[model samples]
Target: MKIKTKSKKVNKAWLHDHVTDPYVRLAQKEGYRARAAYKLKEIDEELHLLKPGQLVVDLGAAPGAWSQYVRRKFAPRDAAGGGAAVGALNGTVIALDLLDFEPIEGVHFIQGDFREEAVLAELQAAVNGRPVDVVISDMAPNLSGIEVSDAARIAHLVELAVEFSQQHLRPDGALVCKVFHGSGYSQLVDLFRSSFRTVKPIKPKASRDKSSETFLVGRGLKQQA
Candidate 1:
């Protein structure tokens, strides 16, 4: 009888790549909660997406890096006397995801599915009926590796993000959503165009070149309210 050993060569390779990745090291150095911070930071730098004191909403804000960034930008400061003073025009951020997140200052975290009406209602309440200045959605479906199915699911999430933006975004507000290049991408882009004055597709520096994921930045949202 021969005994066979299983070599976790692939797992080792993955760990090696992750450990050596520059973004991972940067995240640690910068005190970010996750490496995803670089992704949004790169996107914002290129797009000029976020502003101090602008109300923002974060979709799929788990692990809280994105929330942390938004919170810092909009976090309230103490006034001269003692009370909290308005920082950045008293900007507000509402962060939502299916998984619960530890609270970040200036961010109201809502743990729920965005597709649910109750969740949307909760998000609306968090916004307090104020039109949002920017909406950033990094939602992705739990990959099943069935390309078509996964693409469709992610596309649906993009749709929900767009719908939420329509209801919550102010005139000239912007939206950034992560979408995969497959199945219904074109249709989704078309919808975005119809709702925004400018819709551009972007592959940020932090995004892996091998990955099909990209962000759609929709600017100048049409205000129905």
Candidate 2:
């Protein structure tokens, strides 16, 4: 049928594009888990989100390229600061996801749905009462082929990330999360504005031009009166 043919064509086009993308080739060359590492790299260059000795939580951290980048950038080095060993890194990274991901050297990974209370509790316990300096979320719900429904699902995940940051992040900490620009977008921005002293939206160069996805960085959580 025509529908099947159209689907096949679309798949082929995506495959071709993936094969040719400069970021993909660069990721392979650099040993990153995926091309998405470039997207986070670009954002971090602008924001300086990762720092030495920071405790970070990565939500929806499957495929773990972001965590890998964090480890390489902030992981504690030997006294000489010459080696790339993971366990000696200066900071801690706790990554959570619904899907299984291959282990990263310096990252502690938890597998579970982030929306559940039990999972949240486990994540908090993993932090072990440490003040989280940064929380990053790149979670996206499985699309149902309905735009509105998809938007709502993604929005809910964003909200959960925001709420978790509000509760767990240090007063001067930051949150970086991936969000789409449609439907509940404005409300999410407003939520960030209300909770943090500064909120900025970033669209990294590595992100696909046709995608509506953007990163929201919320910095300096306001003290509750």
Query: What is the lDDT for 62 in model 1?
Result: 94
Worst 10 residues of 2 by lDDT: 76-85
lDDT, candidate 2, residue 167?
A: 87
Candidate 2: tens digits of C-alpha lDDT, residues 69-145? 88887755554572263557778989999999999887899999999999999999999888899999999999897
Could you say which candidate leads in lDDT?
Answer: 2
Model 1 residue runs over 4 Å out of place are 1-7, 75-90, 223-225
TM-score of each: 0.87, 0.94
How many clashing pairs does model 1 include? Answer: 1
Judged by TM-score, which candidate is best?
2
Q: Which stretch of 10 consecutive residues in model 1 shows the poorest summed lDDT?
A: 80-89
Stretches of candidate 2 above 4 Å error? 76-87
RMSD of each: 4.2, 1.7
Q: How many residue pairs clash in each candidate?
A: 1, 3
